[model samples]
Target chain A: MPNQHLIEARGVTKVYQTKDGAVESLKPLDFSIREGEFISVVGPSGCGKSTLLKMVAGLLPVTAGTLELAGKPISGPQRDVGIVFQSSVLLAWRTVLDNILLQAEIRRMPKAEALAKARQLMSMAGLAGFEGKYPWQLSGGMQQRASICRALLHNPSVLLMDEPFGALDAMTRETMNLELQRIWSESKKTVLLITHSIPEAIFLSDRVMVMSERPGSIAAIYDIDLLRPRTLDMMGSPAFAVFAKKVRAHFYSQGTLDH
Target chain B: MLRRLLLLPALRPFLLIILLLVLWDLAIRIFKIPAYLIPRPEQVVQQLFAEWPRLLTESWKTTQATLGGFALTILIGIPLAMVIAYSKLVESYVYPLLVFSQSIPKVAIAPLFVVWFGFGIFPKIISAFLLGFFPVVVSTVMGFKSVEPDMIDLARSMGASRLQTFFKFSLPQALPAIFSGLKVSITLAVVGAVVGEFVGSNSGIGYVLQVANGNFDLPLMFAALVVLSTIGVLLFVAIDLIERLMIPWHASQRQVF
Candidate 1:
């Protein structure tokens, strides 16, 4: 039997009231994510993918319909959710370890346990011997890793990442993608990652959801039948190419949407 | 490379200032400038050494006024910026008033302060505060407003309360920019204190300069000027050091040695 859905959205929409008029950012979007599943949403720039993630994370209010996380309607920012933004957004005044401990501080977790968890998360993210270093000393990729460690520090079951690797270079992005997959697998937390790269979505996600341009809505959701413990070498394989082509075909047929 | 790196801290600025001082001393002597017209470097330094006790007392008075004004600015300015940052209504009501107040030249108000508060330290402190207050308010407002929207969103997503978000994220993030304001305001505080002293004061570097001016004692005047400038530079550097301590993670603070 299929595992119960950890997150459920029904006809959720976002309308931003501007001076000009009411602007619809997201059309009615419906999707369900199972417990411990890795889901990726790929779309063009300004396609409202980030809006959908925010709505589910309870960071933004939905104009219509409903979004339930862990069987409760998301009204405001809930403690169980963790989000990583497009930029690392690490506080420049905080060191790496302190940055991770910020989540514990917010959640009011036990100090000793949080410190131990932070150390474990740092080692997992390959940030050993770098806890005392400040965010400016780190590369873009390392900063993103620190942010990810921060999000996971509180042991939140749901991870919402909005283009976490979008700011990194090509090589760094690939490495981060792999590292993210490993983290996701090890944590077994439900993840909804929003990205523009098709290969990245197909490479990391169990199910990839494509979004349309303006007044964005889900266009398609493709299941990746690829095996787990996936490596970069898989990206060169025919199976990976086929999955990537399937996602690309929708974008190309419509227009240049991916950015 | 090793030598260059070792000397990188103070070498270039030190050499350049020495060169400028040499040029200034030579130019005064070569021009056959009168003692009243221009004091040579040695004359100014000699005057500084000769009246060390008196000048030191005056310097202390000026320093006290500057510190008082700067502390008041920090007390009042940051909270004002916080109000502006948190509420649109407050910003709309207060921002215009701030701009209007800043437009009134502080020097013009210094004499008025003396008239109202009498010729005491209070007038100097108030004058210094008035002059130094605007930059702190303006920069702090900018700092709070300029926080990346995504960062706020990240805090919200993590279920951070408004207070938590402010204390943990917005306040710390705004620090580097706030320090920039502090750096500018502290030097201005020195000028503000002197301006108040110039209007009406029995003691202070400004008062000494005024006495020397009336007597045509150019060397004493130049000596007071040196002391004034040294106070401004030292205050600015102290602010810089605090910025480094508070926000070493900030990009602006991460300079190569």
Candidate 2:
């Protein structure tokens, strides 16, 4: 059988040395992500879900075991990955266009190409006319969209999102979920998303990996059997409800997940 | 029509100044106050014209000292702040020293600067630097530190070097705060320069004040005060304008009007 895995992790663990002593965060996480697959990790607040995401992004070092991308060990910040943080994190001083172009600038991409690509992404994100506007000028959803545009500007192979829409209101979050699904299908990149909401995880992911509480290990992994190009209407369908119930069961069994 | 024109933001301050000057002249006349106490606005304006050449030269001298010290404050203070922000060790060792340096009054230190550097523009610059740099260091440090660690992580994810992360990420975010510090520092720099001049100097507006007081030239002293205040207001406005230019996207610089 052909190995379609684009990202591989074997016995990966994270131990944070706090002032109190060694704090175990993740206990030997073992998972693999295939190319062009959308994977979402759902867990309780202190379940080291974010810790695992950061590790995959190569922002935080894994304390032990192996984490590999394309057969190469991820030793440091991986240039092939794009990250979307919570809170939008848009620079207040830059215009929407410049803010999106910031990633290209950091990578020393050719200015003209970057500008063109930034404009294209802006239009795709429905921010075409607002290029000259600042972050403060845009609505919360718009600012987050611009940040998403920024993450995709450099065309990284993998997109890692850590609760990117957690700050948005309910109505906006639903719309963003739809847009994100479209973006993922069009971009054809491997995606790893960390989230708290079971419905969101099920709606966005090919496989939802549920993690347990502190010193988190994968509690269960469910492969969604729903048909693709899924619609918001499909969310009420039997297959979707089954996935949602299965993910929610983990949270209810492991105590509250209000986090 | 005249009232409507004066209501414009640009003309409002001038309108207020004129109103105050008229009120001042009326009060002096009605109270039958002596010229020696608070010179009439007309008499002060007359004195200002008569002392125009002297006031011009003195103001130029004060301006040079203020700008010099302010330039020094920015050059030294910002880098010093960056150093402290970049390292916890440096901040631990230097932050206390900074606080201690600020504790000893700058006005008291001015006389010492005169004694060391003599009664030259150098002492005035030194005094202004001492007074102005503290605020810059404090504000710039705050600005740099306020950057979200996630912002830095994002930069690192893009392969941004430390220097790149600072200039490209931290610097722009910190600019509004840094500009605020500059505004405060510039005003303090004028006071600092004047303090140095008062401690020991033959030129500058402060020196002119002393000479006018010695002869009891109240009108001339009032004229000097006007000149000194004009310099302070102009420099503060200059820094404010530059902030608008540099960080137009800043919340403080956002368009409300």
Candidate 3:
């Protein structure tokens, strides 16, 4: 059954050494998400949620345990995994279209094909007219949207998002969430998102994995039984409240650990 | 907009020259200053026109030496910076030597260059190259090393090869810093060429200034000085124009006008 999983992490642990001595960022953790599933991992700041995502993305080396994507061990960054960070990081000098086409250029794809894909993705993200505009010329939300389009331009199997909407305002964040949900449904690419917002995690993800404090381990995993094409009305429902409460309790318990 | 334009920052030297000319004209008329001691702006302008042909030829020679030396500096400086930036050992060995060489007074060594290369363009070109090389190397090193760590990591994670990362990220990002260095060095190239001519030379504005001084032709000397200063300003403006054209995305190049 684990072999069927798109991504599987077994006994994954990460330790970092500082001047004070060894600091365990992540404990032995086991997690998996089925193919084409949207999963969100939520935890407090400094809880190693980012570390876990980095390990999965192969940006950081795993200290122990094996992590695999589609039955292949993740030895290094895989071409099939696309990452979007909190900051748009869109290369200030490059136009939105060029930034989106970066993956294709790096991968040495055919120029004509890459240009076509970049144009399609730009329009898909509602950035058709702004293709020639540099990153600094765009608003924060627009830049982040361009970044998302860039990640998807490569047509990767999985999207690794590390707090992509964390920097946006409340209104823009909600709009982006809906836009992301729509994009995900259309593309059908598996996504692993890291977020501290409980409602956001429940809203965007099919499964929310609550993580504990330093030496972070999965405290719990809550599956959202809500119907497909979930709307904002679902957030006021008792089911959503219950899921949010459960995730909140994990954070409260994490706070109590300091004593 | 026209009113706001008048409030724009003025080059102090240009304003100073205008004031100096006013004082010179007044001192010559009121205090009965002799023509040999201080020449009026009108006399200097006349001298400039009278010697226009010789002045033009000398100006061309100096421009050639200055430009050739600057071109040489860029060809050698950038590659050297890249090597030093990529290797810590190379930086440790090369950087100190570079600093030590720059600390030596270039004016003091101009005569030595003339002695070695003779009274020709070679000495002037060499001097200009020596003056221009260090700033380009220093600025380029800063640019190459100043690439954000996160950006580098992001590129690497995308499976970009080292060469790809350098070309795609490092070099473009370094352009702004490198151009600032170039702006400084372009002005220095003019000064270096003049210094070379001052020590020993048969042509150039510096040579003309020397001949005027020997003959006590103060107006001719002032005329040569004016030409030299104008050349420096013009070269600086040319570099600035190139910077705007090449790296339009740079912050400095984005003029409000």
Identify the leading candidate in terms of lDDT.
2
Worst 10 residues of 3 chain B by lDDT: B5-14
State the lDDT of candidate 3 residue by residue for A53-165, as single tens digits: 88888888988899998888888888898888888888877888899888888988899988998888878788999988888888888999998888887789899999999
RMSD of each: 3.0, 2.3, 3.6
DockQ of each: 0.70, 0.82, 0.54
Which scores greater on DockQ, model 1 or model 3? 1
lDDT of 1 by residue, A18-118 (tens): 99999999998889999999999998899999888888888789999989988899999878878888888888777899989988887889999999999
DockQ of 1: 0.70
Q: Once superposed on the true structure, which residue ranges of model 3 sit more than 4 Å away at CA?
A: A1-3, A16-24, A254-259, B1-37, B255-257
Clashes of each: 0, 0, 0
Query: What digit string (tens of lDDT, one per residue) describes model 2 on residues B104-201?
Result: 98888788988899988999999889989999999999999999999998899889998899889999989988998999999999999999999899
**Top-TM-score structure, candidate number:** 2
Superposed model 1: Cα runs more than 4 Å off: A255-259, B1-18, B255-257
Q: C-alpha displacement of B4 in model 2, angstroms?
A: 1.0
Instruction: Summarize candidate 2's per-residue lDDT along A71-144 as a digit string, tens digits.
Output: 89999998889999988888887788989999999999999999999998888888999999888888999998
What is the descending DockQ order? 2, 1, 3
Q: Would you list the C-alpha lDDT of every candidate in the order shown?
A: 0.90, 0.91, 0.87
Could you tell me how far off, in angstroms, the CA of residue B8 lies in candidate 3 after the best superposition? 11
On lDDT, who's better, 2 or 3? 2
Lowest lDDT 10-residue stretch of candidate 2 chain B: B248-257
Model 2 TM-score? 0.95
Model 3 alpha-carbon miss at residue B87, Å: 3.1
